[model samples]
Target: MDNQVRVAVADDHPVIRMGIEATLDDISFIDRIGSVADSTQLVALLDTQPCDVLVTDYAMPGGQYGDGMELIAFVRHRYPDLRIVVLTSMEKLALIRGLMTHGINAVLSKADDMSHLRAAIQATRTGRRYYSPRIANLLKALPATGSARLSQRESEVIALYVGGDSINTIAEKLQRSKQTISTQKVTAMRKLGIETDADLFKYAIELGLTRKKPLSD
Candidate 1:
């Protein structure tokens, strides 16, 4: 049809991808262009396939294009006209605000009903932002005061630190001084209101900042 909205989906999990694709397929005005399992595939598909809307998972790591806020920023810049809807299970206000900052058109919680996907896609198509019920409520209920934006370096430092990397090792890996790494960690923790390493690890795990298992103390 002339007015059909071409949509592509990207999610690392097969089940979630399948469910989203199925939901997109069922939408009357949506044309399911492609569905990919990672950021790399999504970028490649976007390069070749003309799409109007992109529905992507926020935590698809291990892709050369990266994921989370990084991937969203890249896609928003690369395809300025394409509307984006982010699907995530994260409940962190900081992460949600970060996605919005990067210009995603909608934020939909994975826990929301699959039917909400259609609404999100439609809203974005019309140049409006959409948040699923749970996510909207979260935004309303949560205080926005401590949602300090994490710099790219600080985000990287937190991910590495929470993934069980020592300050010394992270410094060596990132080619920075150990003191600098320690400072970054401390600053990131303070911004995040994380009081201890255990809480930092929990925060990382909850936000899907890193895939590595938490280290035992």
Candidate 2:
């Protein structure tokens, strides 16, 4: 294949990894370099391997290098030229915004069809931003939580929480005190008119807050 786009996939689930590989198999221009099960291995591969695009799951547990935002940040810093396509189930606008702010090339939801992945990969390989249609709709539909919009810090707090981080974890990651993190969470929830954690999750989903989880095996 001439000018083939080499792609590496990082996903914990064997099925999802294989599915991505299989999807790219039909595209002659995309060469599947291989797949890794965690962010640690993905980073190692990125150091030793040459790839034009990376398709990685948002959350892969059991890696010392961490997952989600941390790993994304690491990759962006170390491999500035590599195009990143994040595969996630989370619909959180704040989370997506955060990832975009960090310069991720593309984001595709697991719920969307494989065609979306194909488009994302193609667009990203060419240095374009690609967001799944579902994601785009969610972004367009985002509304103010209450009488006032959420502050950047408040949105960051809720985004981390929705991504499965605990209050302490969020505080540690954000370099804020636990009380401050908790207060931000509460404030964000109140602004969204959410009284309970469960309701908060639902509200987040309603507002396109995507839950970051490993693809099902």
Candidate 3:
């Protein structure tokens, strides 16, 4: 195999994918093998031109609206050489764990770190597991099992908010808007049966979502 790595990027949003392309453009060794919007184009590209690595977004339309997992599974079985990395905003460990269980090469979130994206692609090319720093730290801090486990996205929001960052800060970090973050926080609180800031902070720690240090003298 050559030293230069071939990469295929699949995402529904044009702006983000364009940003990703620009980011990869700086890397001398990465060859932009293919770039496609939506899952249909990806399927067509995979059928005609195979890429060394497949970087895609979860919860996107492939077979239909929000059926990315099916396509991934199909690719895993049909094309064994295709190294798959789920590059998306979905931070739920459940979704990450599910995709990884199906033999994905790597699972990365758009929020925690972008530097890891390049590293993950390289790692997957060599047939190894590539979990981002946030994921590795998450696993180190939180267990996946038990009802205490919160979705990765939920934890992300809680971590920022509980850590004293405002909604706008969280928004900028996650590449989302303040309204979206506000709405999600309220929704997640309801789902977790929390009603106040104190309760939410307590829940975040109990779920191993954040590390809120106790006040010291």
Candidate 4:
């Protein structure tokens, strides 16, 4: 077993937190020194006893770009030595590119295998960079889909929609009525030649809106 490496985890869902912690428990190299649900708490903890590596959710409560970007910016400005790897259900290449431009140490999908996550964490901790195969493949494939145009709002709604969030939940989160969210989703789907939620979800994965969810019982 490797020496315990100070680690921090941030995710919105309790189940996700549990899963991450459980995985780390199996790896002696990870100590899981801290955990938080949102960006605010994550930032606060870092200000006091920042861990060797920060694993954060891509998006968080309140719409202030509280995603990994905010925390990444803080680390860049205040704690330049800190390393960060964004673990997210989001597949958007835009967010990945944004993180890269902001000095994020690495980006990994929650859907990736545990080996990939471990490798990324270890690599980033040593000042090396690692982007998962999904991210690298997405970046390479982004240019091929030039004809599909989706507005920013559509993109946001679709991401939530594909990430297993109900339409009502998305509407509530976006501060819009269910009808509006439904209409926009239908319009976006039609424009994209999507017929079912499965198709919509597939397009989202293809467009890098959300990472593919693991199939498990």
Candidate 5:
């Protein structure tokens, strides 16, 4: 396929990688070059087999290189020419905004259908930005937090805490220190004017921070 849009995908879940491959296969202009499980492998693949577009999960575990913002930063720094389309389960407005600053061409939530992914890829190929409808709505609905906006990490910590995960659990899940998680929790609470756990949970629910939909949906 001459002038085909070469694509590489990185996702820890085999089912997700297969699904993305299958989705891209339906597009005649897209060529599936490589599919890997972690950010380290994705970087290695990109070094050897460069692609025009990279579709990756934001929170892929089991890699020497960290996932989420760190992985996105690494890709943006090392592969500046490679267009990135993030297909993630994370719908946090702060996180999406952070990814946008890191040169991500598109952001699509896993809750959305494959049509959004297709649109993102096509738009990215033309040097345009695309956000899934769900993500777009979430971004639009982000409420201001006090005098300063919440950072992505702060929002993540708050979301996990509000979802009933303890500070220790959130620390472990995010690969951060307990103190760091606690500090973020405190900072987030202060910013959102949440004085108690009940208030925080209610606010998180109101903002749709909890992951209600199954990943397979």
Candidate 6:
């Protein structure tokens, strides 16, 4: 049927991928085209397996395409027409907002009922954005000093730092001056009210911003 939604699922957890695939299998209007366990397999799957919507985990490490915002950015750039639904356990509104900024179609909490996955797929299928109830509430309660207050460059700097890159390395990789990277890091911390490097690392981990495992090409 032309209206049937072809869906692909990607997650690092075997059980999560299985459960999501099982759920998709029972949906009348959806076709579970394929499922994979990492970003590498996902990239290969997408390269050949056409799908209408992709339901992927937010923190899937161990793929050549590093996870988090980088993986999302890669997929969005490589497959501009593919609709993406980020199924993550991440609760920080700022992190979620970062995903949204990269043009994802939906963000659903893993805590939400599996049924919400269907709703997310439906919403994305029609080109509308969807957020799970829990995520929506978090957005409603967004604090003024939240990660959303940080500039895009600040967010990038923080993610790279928490991922284990030094200031000089980040500056080199980002093609910015060391002073600019340092300022951005300090400004990001100030915006988030983090007074120390230790606090910043802890906050990044809490927000699921730790550096992902290195991508192996």
Arranged by TM-score with the best first, the candidates are 6, 1, 2, 5, 3, 4
Give the Cα-based TM-score of candidate 4 against the true structure: 0.60
Q: What is the TM-score of candidate 2? A: 0.67
RMSD of 4: 11.6
73-129, model 1: which lDDT tens digit per residue? 788889999999999998766566557656775999999898899899989999898
Runs of candidate 3 with Cα error greater than 4 angstroms are 62-66, 144-217
lDDT tens per residue, model 4, 41-94: 777777787478877777667533355555557656776777777887787655
State TM-scores per candidate.
0.68, 0.67, 0.62, 0.60, 0.66, 0.70
What is the C-alpha local distance difference test score of candidate 3?
A: 0.71
- Per residue, candidate 5 scores C-alpha lDDT tens digits across 100-199 of 6577769999999877777898899898989988888876664466336679999788777766688998999999999999998888776655667766
- Writing each residue's lDDT as its tens digit, candidate 2 over 46-83 gives 88989989999987877867788878878888898999
Give the residue spans of candidate 4 off by over 4 A.
1-3, 63-65, 142-217
What's model 4's lDDT at 106? 82
Q: Give the per-residue lDDT digits (tens) of candidate 6, residues 15-89.
A: 888888888888999988888888999999999988889999998989998888878889888998889999999
**Candidate 5 lDDT (Cα, 0 to 1):** 0.80
Candidate 6 clashing pairs, residues 3+ apart or interchain: none
